[model samples]
Target: MVSKIIALSQGNREYVTDMRRYFHMHPESSLQEFETCKRIQKELTEMGVPFKVVNDIGVIAEIEGAKPGKTVALRGDIDALEITEKTGVPYASTVPGKMHACGHDAHTAMLLGAAKVLWAMKDEFEGTVRLIFQPAEELIAGAKIMIEAGCLEGVDNIFGIHVASAYKVGQVDCTPGPRMASADMMTITVNGVSGHGARPDQCIDAVVITAAIAMNLQTIVSREYSPLDPTVVTIGQMQAGTRANIIANKGTLELSIRSFSPEIRAGLIESIKRVATGTAQALRGTVEFKLTQGTPPTINHEGPTEIARAAAKEIFGEDCLVEREKQTGSEDFAYYSERIPGAMAFIGSAVPGPYVPHHNELFDIDENALPGGMALYVTYALKALAE
Candidate 1:
């Protein structure tokens, strides 16, 4: 059965590749995937697949087999980033300041291919497959809305995939637990007296205070956290003085915090606020610290993980499955995992060249990986439903 699904997926490679390139050429951002959703709707309609819209952008479709036993949902995020394209491919994004650098384009296209394959073979299986064309993964906001709209109401298990640029095209990673980290956004604002730079004692230095706060934040992971427990505190944005010769009155720092455990997440927030506030007081500056919750860790359930691994092994050779370290990067797919048994697989799409990570303007995937990804989805769906 798996081999048949693989053959069907390979046969439909052209359609998947074309759809991926089409999405790559015309990218849309977040909840603004108006035309993207329309295109998806049109494809499903042409395939004779049944679907309905959720929260104006998300699309949920179902493919029932000959008999119903259990339902498994396959999710594909469909939002692009606010980035300009530099890949220089013929299908490089035509939309300026927007690009599908994260491979959500490939995700959507491959899932569509899987839908086609599964629909064709529905007579052999005895359950339903739910297709989720989710939006706004870049903002980590779309999955929640889809859930609120009841995408998971009857879902027995869930599976997702992310295209990876770090490995060769045939390799896949399906590690079972705690695969991706939780993310939280932080903003630290430092306020101090302003004065001429030459008058050292006359003004409180907001720049120095902010710099101190940023450095202290690093300790939350390095010193406070166990080395075995991975965590990251990154201050990515900093803004201070307008002029080089003046002591700035205010400085703001933007930070990204990530971890796998809720306890560790709480500790990170507590330590950050403590350090920032204490550092500011010592520097005779005032501080306002803010933290906003983002996505949680994408912890894979053993059931879904085994299903993915089995599917990968059955479709490709045994060596195709690769062991991978947990990722500090965050994903909104964690939302679904939190509610139901869920797992995600990493499908390699790296080409042989200078490597570029996701969200970069130069990011591109080896299109040869599309068919394998479709096969993985279809096989996983069949395996999960059978179990």
Candidate 2:
């Protein structure tokens, strides 16, 4: 079965790679994937696959087997980062200030490849294979919308993949356990009395209080949490005074916190709030800390992990399987896994030269890994449906 799936996936290499390049050239950012959806729907239509559009941007297609069996879902995110393309590839992003730096273009193409393969061989199997092409993954927002619209109603098992530059092309990482961290966005606002900058004693300085809050927040990880545990609190955005001469009355800080353990996540968030509030109060100021846009960790179940690992080994050989440590990065795919059994496999697509990481301006992947990812998805579907 794996051999047959491999042959089918390989035979469709041109189609898959072409789809990827097309998406890369015309990248779309979060929830605004109109053209992207049209392209996917067109290809699915050409293949005679059944599908429907959800929430304007999401696409859910299905290929049913000759007989009824459990349902399995394959998901791919369809969004690009807010970056300018510098790879200079022939298919580099044509859109300004947007690029598929995270390889979501490859992900969508690979799943489309798998969808075509399964549609062609639908009569050979005995269950359903759901091809979910989701949008706004970069914003971490689409999965919940997909779920709320009944995307996972009858799904028994689910699987997804991400492209990794840290490993060689063709390597696969599908370990069971906490695979990715939870991500929570926090906003901290510090309020102080407005006064002239020259009058140091007349009013409280928000800049100084903001600095104190930022520095104190780091202790949530360094001083509070265990050193062995993985956690990150980064204040990515900070805004204060408009001009240099006058003291700003208010300041805002946007931060992101990531952790794997629930207990640790709770502790980190509480500590952040405590530190921010205390620092503000001590400095004769006040603070407003709000936590939102949060998603839980991506926990891969043992059963689905075994299936993914077995299929990957059978398709790519033993050396292709690489055990990796849990990543501090968070995935909205966790929303799906939180309700059902799901696993996310990392497909390596590294290329030579200065290693460009995801979300960077020059990030790119080896096209060779495209077909391998397609093959992995197809093989897993075959294995999962086999009785």
Candidate 3:
């Protein structure tokens, strides 16, 4: 079965690559993937696969096997980043200021290829394979929307893949447990009395208060949390005085927090509020703190992760499976894993030169990795359903 799956995937390589190039030439942003959704549906329709649209942009397709068994789902995000193309490939994005810099185009194509393969072999299996073509992943809102729309209603296990530029082609990382961090955005505003900057004690200084708040916020990670636990508190933007001679009456700070542990994530939010409020009040000012929750940490399930690992070993050989460090980046896929047994594999797609990170205009994946990803998708579905 594995050998047959490999051959099928290899045969579909050109189809997958062409589809990826087509998507690359016509990239779309989050939630606005209407045409991308339409293109996906058109491809599925051509394959004689049935599907339904959700949230106005997501595509859910199912392939049921010959016998009754548990249902497994395979997901691929179909949104592109807001970046201009710079790789200069012949299939470079035609849409100015928008490109598939995160390898989502490849993800979409691989899932489509897997769909075609599994659709042909439906009579040989004993379950269903649900293909989730999710949108708005860049905003980390697509998965929740898909779930609310019942994409995972009867799913027994779920699997996803992300292309990585860090490792060479043919390598894969299926490490279980806390593979990615949780992200949360925060804003802090400080209010103080306005006065002349030359005046020594006439009014409170919001700039000073804001600076103190930013400095104190860093201590939450250093002094409060364990050094071994990976965490980050970054003040990406700060706004203060309007004039150099006048003491500012209001100041604002924007922050991004990343952590792997839910307890630590919750604790960091409270600590940031505490520090900001304390620092503001100490300077005779008041603070207003606001938080916008993002995706939770992507912790892979042991059972599903083992299945993925075994499948990868069979598809790409034992040495192709390598362990990579935990990533501080966040992924919307966490929403699925949080509700059911799920795991996401990182497939190596590194090009020949220096490493270019995802979401950059110069980012791209080696097309040779597509067939392996497609095979992994088919093999994982079969193994999970047979379990």
Candidate 4:
């Protein structure tokens, strides 16, 4: 199956590479993947694969064989971040401040490469393979919308892959459990009274309350949680009074807290709420908290991890495989794995020299990782279909 996928893709090298660059040039974010969806749908249609396109940046294509067997799915995220591209590649993003820094460009290309290969081999296989192009992965809403749209209607097992810069080219990494962390976003609003800067007692300062809450929230991770457990809470952005002299009435804080364990995530959130409440009450101000939950850790099942490891061995040999530690960075792919047993692995693109990892203006991925990524995408699809 591996040799066959390579043979099929070898002839279309230019086509596949160009497709990735095309996506890189015109980047889209989250639920607004209109043009990206159109391009993917057009290509899938041209290949004669049966597919359904959802309204908000997602597409599911199914290739069914004559005989029925286990049904499996392959997912590729197709959204870009808000960062501007500074790589200056010929395909550098045309849009300002929005780039495909997260390797979704390679992801979409690899899946399309696999789709072309699988369409040719579908007749020889005995099951169905659904190729999913997910949107809003960066926004953390694409996977949920895809699930709600019934993309997982009859799937037995599913698998997804992320392009990693940590591993060098030609190597693929997998872990049996806890590959990524769950990210929960919190926004705290402190409302108070506004008055002249000179009149200290005339107004209640929202900035004072906001600063107290932020400082106290930091303690929740360092002092409150168990010393053995790992937790991280970062205040991404903070906004308050517009001018230096004005005592603003309201201040807002946007923060993200992440943890590897589900129990830890729950506890941290509860603690955040308690701290917010206590801090606001003490400051004689009111607080409003808006928290949104993102992806759960991409936990790979043991059985599926073993299968993926074996598949990796066949391509890069036994020594080429490695196990990566849990990453605090989150992926919406957790939604799919949460529904069924699956595995999500990382493929390396970290090449030598000054290269940005992801979401950086100078971020660049090693092109050598393309063939390996294409290989895994096709091999996983074939393996899942055969199982």
Point to the candidate with the largest TM-score. Answer: 3
lDDT for each candidate structure = 0.92, 0.90, 0.94, 0.84
Per-residue alpha-carbon lDDT of candidate 1 for residues 181-299, written as tens digits (9 for 90 to 100):
99999998999999999995999999999888888877777888899999989899998887988998899999899999878988888999899999999999999978799988899
Mark the regions of model 1 whose C-alpha exceeds 4 Å error after superposition: 191-211, 239-250, 281-286
Q: Give each model a TM-score.
A: 0.90, 0.91, 0.97, 0.88
| Better structure of 3 and 4 per TM-score | 3
Residue 223 C-alpha lDDT in model 4: 89
Q: Per-residue lDDT tens digits of candidate 4, residues 290-359?
A: 9888887778888677767777776667787877668788888888888898898888888688655677
Q: Which candidate, 1 or 2, would have the higher TM-score against the true structure?
A: 2
TM match of model 4 to true structure: 0.88
Clashes of each: 0, 0, 0, 0
Q: How do the candidates rank by lDDT, highest first?
A: 3, 1, 2, 4
* Candidate 4 or 1, higher lDDT: 1
Give the least accurate 10-residue stretch of model 1, judged by summed lDDT. 213-222
Candidate 2 segments whose C-alpha is farther than 4 A from its true place: 194-208, 237-249
Model 3 C-alpha lDDT per residue in residues 1-387, reported as the tens digit of each score: 999999999999999999999999999999999999999999999999999998668999999999988999999999998898999999999999999999999999999999999998999999899999999999999999899989999999899999999888889999989999999999998999999989938989999999999888878888999999999999999999999899999999999999998899999999899899988988999999889999999999999999999999999898888998898999999999989999999999999998899888899889999999999999999999999
lDDT of 2 by residue, 1-387 (tens): 777888988898899989999999999889899999999999999999999998779999999999999899999999998899898888888999999999999999999999888988898999999989999998889999899878899999899999999889878999998989999989999999878888958988898899889888877788888888889999999888777777878999999899987788888888988899999999999999788957899999888889999999988898888988898888999999999999999988998777888899889999889888999998898788773
- Cα miss at 46, model 2 (Å)? 2.0
